[model samples]
Target: MSSQPPEPPPPNPTTAHGSDRKLRADARRNRERVLRTAQQLFATEGLGVSLDEIARRAGVGPGTVHRHFPAKEALYLAVATDQIRQLVAEAEALAASSDPAALFTLLSAMMASGAENVAVKSALVAAEFDLRTAAPDVAADLTRHVADLLDRAHAAGTVRSDLTVEEVMALVAGAFAAIRHIGAETSRDRSAHIAQLILDGLRPHPR
Candidate 1:
């Protein structure tokens, strides 16, 4: 007698939400690992590194990596997004400071950090992949943070009032490009020096 399959166990309300939370947490951890591993490999190995290799280094299967990042470009963009987010946070903190020199110094450091991530530097050369266009929200947030910092510096009579926010951003981007020309290892020092030099040009001239 197929005893009515033992009455189905009562549904556990907490079980589903718990499982979902754990799954989301695990996914985030895996995604982070993938990004870190990819950044290292790409930096040392260039964009030629295989997805399988990234997955192996990340301790996840190739399918899992693909599930999170459907293509190589997507993964690269994710890395850039993460880097920009960190830079934006730093910019926000420095925006409140009265010291223009310190603010520019911090901005240079942030660009150096981005340069260190191989994928990010490489992506910089890819014209088809515009971080600002691809990740507008992140870019806008970052731009706003940077603008605020520039405005603060200008208000303090430290920075040039004639330069627009766009001009400052262009300088920052140009700094990164120049840093890339010198290579990532030297980019930090070179960028800081260049930033200071640019800052000199931006400073309010004494009448």
Candidate 2:
């Protein structure tokens, strides 16, 4: 018999959607686990910590880590990217209030996170991960907010006129290391102590 128009391929719309949704969910969970594990290990062990270790700790296969991050640099950038985004958001939010203490308050919070912050920042710098290249928008946003906060505080006579955001970042990095070595039992105590010291240094003195 003459063949009629061939039947179209069977539609599996519901099955396709279900499979895709489940896949997306699994991917998201895997990525989050990898990121969390990476953050912890990188902070604790520096950038030299292997991807294998991260994958193992995350309870995923090496293939999974690679699936999420094509390369180690990408993973490192992702971590720093998240950090910079947070820092930018914090600066912008605090700047909105124009509270003279906002800049110092932000510094307190940064130091409060302890040397993990320092180590991560250090690793990124050491790895030469270009913030502008990897996450230009967030990096530029962070820079802008930082400049805004420092300039405003300086103009208001709340902060030293000669002080710069560069100085503040460097100072916090140093202070974080010191507090880590101090080995305080409580982060609250450590944070407060570091915060006060930083604030003291940032205070405007009579010329």
Candidate 3:
């Protein structure tokens, strides 16, 4: 008796597409892991940390990091841009909230984030990579979120009446510079205090 092997099942496009999507999702996650690890290392270990070290810390292969970033500058830009995207997400959440003090909360987070990543930001600046120019869409999205929060604060009388979104953005940049200037970037308490002073200045003054 000739026993013919069972016919192979027909290819399923749906299953193939699902597998492709999963692969893309995994790649996105790996890239994000590299970005976060690079960001922490750059901030704590300075910009001298190697990509291989970042891969080891991120639990990915060196090849993966290289495949995604290619160079330190690319990783630097990705880290900085990732930080801003996180802030934009936070701002979006705050915008959805009914809390009147969301603006201050969001601002505090922004300052803390900037202080934490001051090293990376400085490295990018040294490399002449302005995030506003490099990642304009994400940068603009964050700015828009800040503007929305500022408007809400104005209506709620939470922030100063004279304050504008540009000034608020400038204050964040200034906070980063001040954190770097006093070498408080590594000192959470000191950097926070500086941010607090800046935030306090944004409050409505009692006549």
TM-score list, all predictions: 0.82, 0.68, 0.92
User: Model 2 clash pairs?
Assistant: none
Candidate 3 per-residue lDDT over residues 37-134, each given as its tens digit: 88888878888889999999999999999999898889988998999999999988898899988989999999999999998888889999999999
| Segments of candidate 3 deviating more than 4 angstroms | 1-11
Q: Model 2, poorest ten-residue lDDT window?
A: 113-122
Per model, state how many residue pairs clash.
Answer: 0, 0, 0
Candidate 1 minimal-lDDT segment of 10 residues:
183-192
TM-score ranking of the models: 3, 1, 2
Q: How many backbone clashes does candidate 1 have?
A: 0
Candidate with top lDDT is 3
Q: Give per-residue lDDT, candidate 2, residue 128.
A: 82
Candidate 3 TM-score to native? 0.92
- Residue-level lDDT of model 1, residues 69-173, one tens digit each, is 898888888888888887877776676665766556666666566556645656655737888888899989988877777777777777777977898778767
**Candidate 2 residue-wise lDDT, 4-106, digit = tens:** 9988999799999999999999998998889888988876666788888899999999999988788887887777787776777788789889597777777
